[model samples]
Target: MEIRHNELIQMYPIGYVHNIFKEAIFDEKMYSSVSHIVLKEEFQDGLKDITDFSKIYVLFYFDRSEGYNLIQKRRYDGKIAGVFASRSPRRPNSIGLTLVELLEVKGNMLTVRGLDAIDGTPVLDIKPFIENDMAGDDLRSA
Candidate 1:
């Protein structure tokens, strides 16, 4: 079956990223990039009571990523795979996700760690990762 599409869905940035990652590539090493999520003044009220959580799920946009190839070389295996199978930044839609530690929340700025998104990237949304069934990965032994 052919899947038709619509453009009714849209997203706006709730904030902007602040980090040392000037370019999309990481420092000499592959995973040394670090960034912080700084929410806009208007969204400050939405972050109330979020400090109780330790980890936050960050949703961002890869604005710098212009276009993507369906199949690209995997950084690990050096093998070409579908974009869906790998974590390459290039995508039909430039949405990005990262689970980072909520180090500290001061006003509208949130200091986080373990995120790889570029600086000035648009932050779509932020969700706290609470310890609950929905946040579990439990499964029966295979």
Candidate 2:
């Protein structure tokens, strides 16, 4: 899991998210927001069979975050915590992940609900959401 210091890493977006959300929000509206994932024409074939899942994980970039702090106050509670402990967009890699409800798929586009990403966000990757990965019968309280 370790790479050489001189190694180079690169990634190209296969698609972009289209939505009405213009800013960061963590409200009830977010749960109802409908967004579209439009994949490049070349990647259209990748959408095949994706509709079988009810949910999928969206991996995207926090392209708008300016900089980051290792420690910060929680937005909802004003409590101090490490950035890693919080969901703030600012981060070491600026990558964001959200598990969203899959609604429908059309050609190279997918309609999904509950995607928190804003319009034009670059989608790094997508994965099927498997409930077995949650690890437990007893969930830990956040």
Tell me model 2's lDDT, rounded to 2 decimals.
0.87
Q: Write the per-residue lDDT of candidate 2 for residues 22-128, one digit (tens) a residue.
A: 77655668678899999999999988899878999999998878799999997868889999888788898889999999999999999999988888999999888
> lDDT winner among the candidates?
2
Per-candidate TM-score against the hidden true structure:
0.82, 0.85
lDDT over C-alpha atoms for residue 119 of model 1: 83
| Counted clashes in each candidate structure | 0, 0
Instruction: Assess each prediction's global lDDT (C-alpha) against the native.
Output: 0.82, 0.87
Task: State candidate 1's TM-score.
Answer: 0.82
Cα RMSD (Å) per model? Answer: 4.8, 5.0
For model 2, state the Cα shift of residue 22 in Å.
Answer: 2.1
Which candidate should be chosen as best, given TM-score against the real structure?
A: 2
